[model samples]
Target: MAKAKVTDEQIIQVGSELQKADKNVTGHALCKVLGGRPDRLIEVWEKHLLESNSDENSLQYIQLSAGLEELFQSMSNDILKSIKSVLATCEQNILTQADKHVENEKVACAERVSALREQLNDANDIINQNQDQIDSLLKENQIINNKYQKTIELEKSVVELSTKLEGYTTAIKDKERIITEQAARIESINAA
Candidate 1:
């Protein structure tokens, strides 16, 4: 086909104005305004219009089915991986915190045991001190008992000595009386 003498810019411009006015760019109508062969101009313009509309539609409604599906799948995988990583980190933190808590509890138990041991030792010391006091009191009691025994023995000796002195005094008085009687008898015989 011979290249149409009519410019594409003119055809598109008039066509846009006609479309805006809600008029059809028919062969007779465009031919009357642009002074071209109606059939040739309309045919060429229609072909160009069809090709441009095709390109415009391609731009307006892009063919993204395959690319978008791939992108969505990749994003889903990335999100899943991120979530798994976050959950793993949280689990690790929880375990570490639990271990720390267990260690703290063990330390607390150790401290309590140490304190209890100290208390036990103190109690034992107090008991030992009381036992020592009891031993000292017993020794003092034994000493007092020994002193009382000696006192009792001394009293018995004093009573025995007093009894012996009384016996000796009575015998001496009896001897003196016997000597007086014998002397009186001798004097009576001399008188006779």
Candidate 2:
């Protein structure tokens, strides 16, 4: 005997009604409900199962996407915090180094100023000593000049005394000549 042909719509409707009734919609159950070949019902039931599972998979994909988005936001926040911490630490380090550099410069400047003052004091002392030596030399030079002037005056006196002695010698010679002539005349008279 030839089997009755069930329509595709009728099979699909029966499968849906069985599912709504909370009954197993297997090929054997459809065959009993619709009096059709199990093979035909099995094909339609598998198609419906594939469609339902596809819808569930799409919902799960949406949920998974939302979860991934939340995770991405959390990670970004963590990265930003870490960057801020690093920047703050770098800023603090730069400030500390700058302070140290300023302190070092101040110390160096102070030392240089102190050294310059010491050099200035030494120069002043040297200048004072040179001035003292110049003063002593000037006094010695004045004494030598005074002694030279005294010697020149004494030489002038000696020259004047020698000229007076020469004049006296000439007068003495003239007196002796006159006395010799007088003594000669006296002897001649006595003889006569």
Candidate 3:
């Protein structure tokens, strides 16, 4: 006898039912339920497994995004603290220089003040650069969040499609039962 044709819908239905029953949805089990070649059933099973794995991978991506955001926040906080400490030390040095009494020391203090001003300018540049970097990181984080939201939406769509498939499967089964009952009635009348 020729092999029976198995539709993707039937395979999906069988897989869903097997999963609902908490049974192992292996190729062998699917073959017994579906009556197709073991190899073909295994291929279908592998495809299903891949789709599930993709969803799991998406979840991992979301977790990684969260971890990265936390790390960026920590780094930004540390940079801010370092900047504050540097500013405090600079202010203290300026105050100490102003307390000097000797004329020669006063001239030296003037030169030191100029050098400190240059250093302050350089520090401001660094702060500005760091701020730009933080802004860029924030933008990247926003992009990642958007991608995560899109992934969530895609997952929701998949669930909706599965629900619709189940409904269609039920309708097909009901029609089949009706056809079988009608055939039986026709046979009984012919026999009578």
Candidate 4:
């Protein structure tokens, strides 16, 4: 009764009903009951069924084909669902890996920043130490310069003292010569 192919089973069932009613049926009657053309091959097929034995092989082939079609449809649906599930899982894994990679990069960046900060701190410490050393060197140089200046002033004093000592020695020699001349004149007059 379904609106699709005219299956032989429906024809056979109608013929059986006609037989039970003790009424003789023909191909035209069967086609009329099935709401098809009485001159169609479907009517001839029904007539063949009434005359000869049914083609069991063809019937089996049709049944098997229908079963295979149903099975193939079911398998296709199952495969599509499985493929969708696998694709979703793959997408989730990709997202998770991306998140982990991002976190790792962040951690690496933080570590690098920490290392750079430490290096900067160390550099600052070195700079401060160098500054202290420079200051100490400058103080030492200033002290040395003061000592050199004092030594230069002492050398000038020594030069002036040496010049005065030479003048005093020349004056003492002149006085000694005059005393010797006076003693000689006194002895000569007494002798005269």
Winning candidate number (TM-score): 2
Q: Supply the global lDDT for candidate 3.
A: 0.89
Q: For candidate 3, lDDT tens digit of each residue in 63-142?
A: 44778889978998999999999999999888777765466788998999999999999999999999999999999999
lDDT of 4 by residue, 1-192 (tens): 556456667777877787789977776777778866555534655576656655655564564478888997899999999999999999999999999999999999999999999999999999999999999999999999999999999999888888888887878787777877888888998999
Model 1 misplaced stretches (Cα beyond 4 Å): 1-76, 172-192
Mind giving the per-residue lDDT tens digits that candidate 1 earns over 93-154?
99999999999999999999999999999999999999999999999999999999998998
Go through the candidates in order and give each one's C-alpha lDDT: 0.87, 0.89, 0.89, 0.81
How many clashing pairs per prediction, in order?
0, 0, 0, 0
Which lDDT value does model 3 have at 20?
96
Q: What are the runs in model 2 whose C-alpha is more than 4 Å off?
A: 1-67, 176-192
Task: Flag the better candidate by lDDT, 1 or 3.
Answer: 3
1 versus 4: better TM-score goes to: 4
Between candidates 2 and 4, name the one with more favorable TM-score. Answer: 2
- Model 2 per-residue lDDT tens digits across residues 90-148: 99999999999999999999999999999999999999999999999999999999999
Candidate 4, poorest ten consecutive residues by summed lDDT: 37-46
What value of lDDT does candidate 2 attain over all alpha carbons?
0.89
Model 4: residues >4 Å from true position, as ranges? 1-74, 179-192
